[model samples]
Target: MSSLISIVLPVFAVIGLGWLAQRRGWLGDGGAGALNAFVFRIALPPLLFLAMARTPFEAFGQWRFLAAYLSGTAGVWVLVWWLAPRLGFNGFQARWLTCLGATFSNAIYLGIPLFETAFGALSAQPVILIALMMNLLLVGGSLIVLQAVSGEGTRAAIKETLSNPMLFAIGAGLLVSWFDIALGDGADRLLSLLAQAASPVALFALGVTLGVAGSGVRFGRPQWVLLVAKLFVHPALVALACWGFQADAINAQAAILIAAVPAGSLVHVVAARRGTLETESAALILLTTAVSVVTLTLLLEWLL
Candidate 1:
């Protein structure tokens, strides 16, 4: 109990601080964007890079874990995609957004920080692997879905995915690890310094984003569907997959926790960019994040 509180409380407190700051106007106009830019462009890339670069090459060969996790995610996506039309989200954009909200986990902003707190940084290999897979599969796949639904050319989606610094960092890190290249002490220290800033900054930025984007939003039955699918169904499927695959206990728990994270803000970003379901997508992000605090804490207690 104490272990769970110790891990969960401080993370939520920082997020709460950011929410309060935004509510109080402590950060002026565009503050959230600036913070997000810093985290995405500067802090998170190095963190992911270092995590991947330092990981053993064999860690990349965990095919069973990957299969289990991706299977759960893909299942939820397909289920949401098919159900959206029946649920009155008949438009392609609406259907795509619903599918995205169901499967996309906030792996970078929330998962990494929470996992680092609960399991220790040295134990983040599973989280990193899952994050990488989510980025490639969920994020990349969203672009293709959007293009198909909205008649938007695949060029923009392809460009966005290819230009993602986090994806590039992951690839570079894996390459370095695969080739056994050493980035001497000087480079290591620089990366370590940048990596140290990812968690707190990301949490704060998330709070600010919630405040800004969730303004005047109202939830309905569809929103409830999205929340339940993301927070419960997805994780349950991942846990079942882990058991079926006979994964190690730690990796199994890690996969379930990652799957339980809230829907990513990227869903909202994509919806807004495509001019479809932007407000609802933002509301879903806020609701899922606010609710995930309790869900995640409970899951951590059970898993630990």
Candidate 2:
């Protein structure tokens, strides 16, 4: 409990502060978008690149560990999709939004900060492993969900994912990692500098999106169902999956903690772009985020 609270509360406090800042017009209305753009286009790329670049490929011995973590996430997504309509969500809304909630975690913004606080630099290994899976899902699976929800078929979705700048950066970073090229000192420093801006900007962007005119998420039965799935069911399954895969203690804890995060901020962005369940998607983000502090804390105490 202490571990989860220690991590989730402070991060959400930062987000709350950003929300207040936006509400008070301290940073101006456009500040959030600019922050998001900076983080997504510049900060996140360098962060992902540096993270991948620094990982000694030899440490990636436990392929099953990564497999279990990702497979568990996908499994939960499928469950959410099947149960969403019964839970009061429409088919399109349930499929995409449930996936948005299930798949991509706020692992970068929230996970890095929490992992750093709880376990220090050593935690970066598991976090990056999770991030790598996130890259794959965001690039591949997110598009699939959008297409399925919209009944738009595969071609348009593929085009959008391929053309996404953030996905392109992820692909480029993987290439650098695959080739095992060492970054020069100056280049390394530059990457470090850009990477440092990722969290604040990402959170602020979320705040701005939250404040958008049509972006308010309403908390009704359907939203609560998604929240429960994300905060409780997903974490429990992830823990079992991690244990089944024989993940080390730290890796297991990281899996559950990462799973405990609310829906990804990108979900709102995708929801808006796809024009499917935007309000419901926003509601899931806000509600899950608000409730996760307690739920995650409880999970940590029980699991840890």
Candidate 3:
């Protein structure tokens, strides 16, 4: 329990500091945007690059881990989308937003930091793998779903996915790792410095974003669904899948923890870009993030 607190509290505290900074007007109106730009362009790409560069192809043999994670995550996505209409969440955008809120984990901004804190930076193999998996499957698939239903062209989605710097970094890192290309000590150290900044800055930017957009939205049916689905149903399914797949202990625990993270920023991004349920999406992201502290802490105590 104490260990879990040690991991969970400090991360949330930094996020809270950012929220406070935003609320107190310490951050300018564009502060969150600027910080996010830096994190995405400067910090995260190097972090992912380094992580993939170090990850051996042998680690990719954990098909069981991917099997479990995919089953759980995709299961949540399908279930939420199917149930949304029945629950009176009408329209493609609304249902998609609800499904996204339920299934998308904040793997980048929050998951990396928490996993690094709990399991150490060397364990970032699974962390990065899981993050990459989530982004590709969930976010990528969301666009396809939107295209099929809402008449949005999948061409844009394909372009965006192909052009993403993080994915490019991951691919480059994999080639380097696989072929054993050695970047010298200086380049490695430079990347390491940038990588170190990804977590805190990303978390701070997330908090600032929440401070900017998470308010003025009253709790509604969507929020209620997000509350239960994100915090409970999704994680529970992932844990069950882990057991079912007989995943190795370490990967099983990591997979479960990854599933337990909050609604990701991409949910809001999708909603905002498409002019959908922005307020509710923001509320879902904020609500799930706040509640995951308790939920994940309990989960870690049990898993440990």
lDDT (CA) per prediction? 0.87, 0.71, 0.85
Residue pairs clashing in model 1 are none
lDDT string for model 3 (1-304, tens) is 7878988999999899888989998977789889989998899999999888888767768878778988998888888989898877788778877788898899899988888888888777776788887787778777767876777678888787767788888888988888988999999999999999999999998888888877787777768776788878888898899889999888888888888989898888888877888888888888888988899899878877
For every candidate, C-alpha RMSD to the true structure in Å? 1.5, 3.0, 1.5
Task: Report lDDT (Cα) of residue 65, candidate 3.
Answer: 78
| TM-score of each model, paired residue for residue | 0.95, 0.85, 0.95
Q: Model 1, which residues run further than 4 Å from truth?
A: none
What candidate 3 gets wrong by more than 4 Å, as runs, is: none
Q: Using alpha carbons, what is the TM-score of model 3?
A: 0.95
Q: After superposition, how far is residue 179 of candidate 1 from its true place, in Å?
A: 2.6
Better of 1 and 2 by TM-score: 1
Each candidate structure's count of clashing pairs: 0, 2, 0
Candidate 1 accuracy as lDDT: 0.87
Q: What's the alpha carbon RMSD for model 3?
A: 1.5
Count of clashes in candidate 3: 0
- What lDDT tens digits, residue by residue, belong to model 2 across residues 114-218? 666667654566776686577556645676766775687888777765665655665666667777888899998988888777766666666565555224446
